[model samples]
Target: MNLGRYIRRTAAHQPDAEAVVCGPVRLTYAELDDLSNRLATALRGLGLIRGDRVATLAANRAELVVTEVALYKAGLARAPINARLGATEVAHMLRESDARVLLTDAAHLETARVAAPGTAVKTVLGYDGPSELGPGYAETLDGTAAEPVEVDCAPDDAAVLHFTSGSTGKLKAAVQTYGNRLALLRKSVMSADTRIGPGCRQILAGPVTHASGMPLMGIFFAGGCAIVLPRWDAEEFLATVERERATHAFVVPTMVNTVLALPSARDHDLSSLRQLVYGAAPMSPQRIREAWELFGPVLSQGYGCGETTSGVLFLSTEDHRRAIEGEDEELLLSCGRPLAEAEVRIVDDAGAPVADGEIGEIVVRGPDVVPGYHNEPDLTAETFRDGWFHTGDLARRRSDGYVFIVDRKKDMIISGGFNIYAVEVESVLHQHPDVFEAAVVGVPDERWGEAVKAVVVPRDGAALDEAGLIEFCAERLARMKKPRSVDLVTALPHNPNGKIDRRAIRERYWAGAERRVH
Candidate 1:
């Protein structure tokens, strides 16, 4: 089934149900569908044809959702540009994707115009506000028909060309198919009986352009209400949760850490949040325990990459219970088991399966896995060897079958002929009572090829010196695993998706290096 079909089905079955709530604006399923139909008609009038690409450069608003639905309904693929990207990066993506039209608001109009100067973008639609482009956004369907255009879309048709964060290097577009998206939604619905129902509120706080936004479609598929936040704020997130009575919400580890640090967290009434899913980065066991204490046992974890439609593995509620009860320390470090219709395995460098309790590259295969990258054939072939997508993550599988991620292939540090996983060091550092967040990276060393460095953010008003932190890590970890230097900061840099920007941190140390990986 097509991704656009979700919107149509929900609109038809629950026409009056609240589909989206952004700030003061709220749209019913019927309204959302009709508005998308109008946008589709407008796009067609601008000479957009089947298979043409349309790009959106907006925040998490109703317009962004409408643009995606309209483009899909008209048999056009939609590319949602990350609002945090620079002009040159945005332009490169537009040119690479061959976007035929751009839908942007006043906030990003100049950036969009500068990016695609003379590309295939023939028409640009602005949001409803004053801008240099003229008065405001215009409706192309004043009295036009609201019926959806009948365009043929197969499961193999490219539905989305989403760009990755480019942490390794230049951003690459991941081609998503109708089948992949359908598989994700189907899995989400059947995973748990706590399905989103009519008027069930969902909070959208993460970047809508990222994979985190994919699950929001599942809420739409289940005829639920989505509360969109333009950006995430600690207090605002809590307020929205309380005011909207949101049932489901997704946030990265950084966001959760920020919310927990808020002084008002204890004062806010957040009883409405039922399922709080956290991923996109590793969550410290200490932080998880504190969150469980505050938010109860409703927190869950999802693990996946952009290459996968969204989530391939789910750390279920029962797993959280096991962790809370101190059943196993390894379970807390795991990203949990694979979801239904997914297969996960750890393989060695030669693609041979590794034995349990051994570390190797994590490979996944499933219906939600994308066929390949958009245009990088060589990269696609290299990544999809032997019918499994190599995740570039080092992981070890316990005898119990739960996978524990060691570190990224590039993030591993070798010092004095000893291998060190940054995650292992960071996990130990976070166990300290004074440390709020920590990131471990390798830096140049004279005696050793590399030395482990810990960048930490201390708990508010808590005093943590470098010597004390080193001593704390040394108490629990081996001498070689201890950090050589500790850098304390108020907050760690984060990417648009809210994950710690390890690339940025590495670049500071390896500015002139030829290779990023040590």
Candidate 2:
């Protein structure tokens, strides 16, 4: 069934229930549904056909959410572009996706116009400004009739195309189906009644273009209230949580680190926060511990990629408690077991399962896993072999059934014939009292073929020299696993999704290389 049906159902069931909030502005389920239908009608008036691609370049806002639901209702594929992406990257995605209509707010009108010059986008609709299409672009559709349009979309038909970091190379759009999204919501509900709590308000700070924000659909599916933060600010986030009585929220590692570093962190009455989900990158155990101490056991972690539409492995509240009680460090480091319907395995080079504790390429098979990429048959063949999605991640399954991700299969550093996972070294560095965040990469070495380098961001008011940090790592890790060099920085660069920009880090060091070989 089409996802737009859910919006209609929710509106009928709870017409007056709070649906979405952007700062002070709010909309009920009935209002949101009607607005989306009117927007769909507007797109239809613009001569948009079924399966046409409509792209939105905006942050987390009520208007953006309205546009997405409208696209789905109008039978157009929704492609939400990352606003943090560079002009060249945005141009490439617009050209590659062959978007038929482009939508933007005042902030991104110039960028959107430049990115898709001479493209099939017949008109540009800007929110809340005088556009070429005139001033009616941002009107509320409250009184408009909700006329549902029928389109031929199977369960497996592509509903959204989410772009990956492209840190290894060019960005790849991971195709997500309606079936996959529904499966994710189903599994998430089974894992825990994520909707329970007084004042069930949720804050979304991550970019809506990513799967991190896509889970908000589940909140909507359950008829819960969502508060959207256009961009992340430590003070603003804390204030919103307290003022709105937000019970749930999720942010990436960097945002978590920033929030913890805020001087007034302890002063905020964040008691309303019941569940704090964090992922998209490996967070330091020390950082996690600090977060637990500050926020209580409400903090949890989820592990997945755009291919899975957000989370396949979820570290629940019980797991968080176990980790705090010192049950097992290995379990704490793991991304947790697969969801009920998801199957995860570690496989060898010959497509055979490896023994427990043996590292191999991680593979996952489930209804939630995407079947293939958009149009790249060769890459799809390489990624989805034998009906399983090869995650390109190296991991080992523990005796307790949890899986610990080592590193990207292509990111494993072989120095002096020793296999070194960058995460292991970075985790060790994170244990240092002065270190706030860390990323480790492999650089070319004449003697070892590849040498390990650690780039670190120190915590506020903490001083960490290279020697002290190296000594700290050497204490916990073996000589070969320790970083050969430690470079201290105020902060590491991050991609739009908030993961460390390792490619940007390596480019400076590997400029003359023919190719970047891990």
Candidate 3:
């Protein structure tokens, strides 16, 4: 089966429909289908065989979407590098994936040039224009003859080399297969909260090469328009939704915090928002309430990782209304029940199912779960055991089947003899009206072996001190869970996915310490 056939069918159905929009560039269904086919033909002409890898290192743009569809048509594995990565990380990916071709823009042409010297990258295609490193993107596609190119691929054929590094900072690629990707497309539309069809405009506001790109295939297959943000600015996001009449959006919690902080947030006409989904990190109950008020009953949440392909759990708009306007107040903390075709269970270390209200790891079994990592067999064996992919996340299932993520197994803070989840502490920190952002980490303590440290960023013009913030959390959380000390800073670092960089903040405190909790 060819994944690109879905796009071909959609194009045949609505040739003149808008498929993608970014900045000043807009491509109709005919244009997108034709360009991707031509680009696939061009890559094949360049001698890239099926299962060969093609890497792209660029920010959100119209060409990235084209490249994704092109790779699907060519039956080539996609290795998408985050644009925010430095030259060293980019070079590491080039070496690890051994990608034959690299696609980039003028902004990253120099970095690509610097990193492609001894790697397998034989050519680089520039999106903006021809550079010293490679030829122009538009000219290359224009030169190739547009044909209906679709390579038949097996179910287990590798489709995407999804690279991610959590707190450990070691990059690992999850080999997502063709069947897995098809499962992702199926699940995207099966859930009522994630469904998008014709006349549905979905805003992709983050880097499209990773988490933000998960919804693209479904949007294309369903004949929906994708409005890609050139860059992330809260005001620009609001304006784009109003201007494009966008009906759906998927954002990280950090992005939502920035939108809530905007003084004119309520003034914007966000009436077109049919579904506003947030994930990557848990949002505070207070922030959920604020977002519901701002976005007008469109807020929802999704929970998943690359290993699971995309989301396996979804908190729908009805769930949000039930929590915010109804009696299920604690439902605000749940990431929600299992989504479309996924089997989710909380299992102990021995892989035994845990009873309700018991904390354990979230193990998922589904067609969307990848087989294993590309080159790390040992790590793969450790993460994917038997038939279930271990999420390494600590969560508890309520009697009603709702799941609340306690924290990542690695992010749990061991203070004295107590197990304190950083997310639990951070949730209370977010309740303070003066706090804009907060990160909780465990630091070396001479007395307790390790102590909890809170790093907070106050809202604009809010005079919040460390004592006030610590006291606020103390009132809401357990005495042992309360931060031992608080640091009021201007901002907290974030990873490429818009999640708080607790690893970065914690590293500073444990840089040269003799004992470390993480």
Best by TM-score: 3
Across residues 54-100, which tens digit of lDDT does each residue of candidate 2 receive? Answer: 87777777888887777767777877788877767888777767787
Instruction: Return the TM-score for each candidate structure.
Output: 0.96, 0.96, 0.99
Higher-lDDT candidate among 1 and 2? 1
Flag clash pairs in model 2.
none
Clashing pairs in 1: none
Evaluated at residue 405, the lDDT of candidate 3 is 94
Give me the runs in candidate 1 sitting further than 4 Å from their true place: 129-138, 141-144, 512-517
Worst-scoring 10-residue span by lDDT in model 2:
134-143
Residue-pair clashes per candidate = 0, 0, 0
Off by more than 4 A, model 3? none
lDDT of 1 by residue, 434-479 (tens): 8888999998877887899999999989999999999899998999
Worst 10 residues of 3 by lDDT: 165-174
Candidate 3 lDDT over 1-518, as tens digits, reads 78998899999999999999999999999999999999999999999989999999998999999999999999999999988888888999999898999999888988997899889999898898888888888999889999999999999999999999544688889999999999999998886778899989999999989888999999998999999999899999999999999999989999999999999887778999999989888999999998998899898899998999999988888988999987798899999999999999999999999999999999999999999998899999999999999998999999878999999999998877889999999999889988899999999998888899999999999998877777787888878899989998998999877888888999999999976767
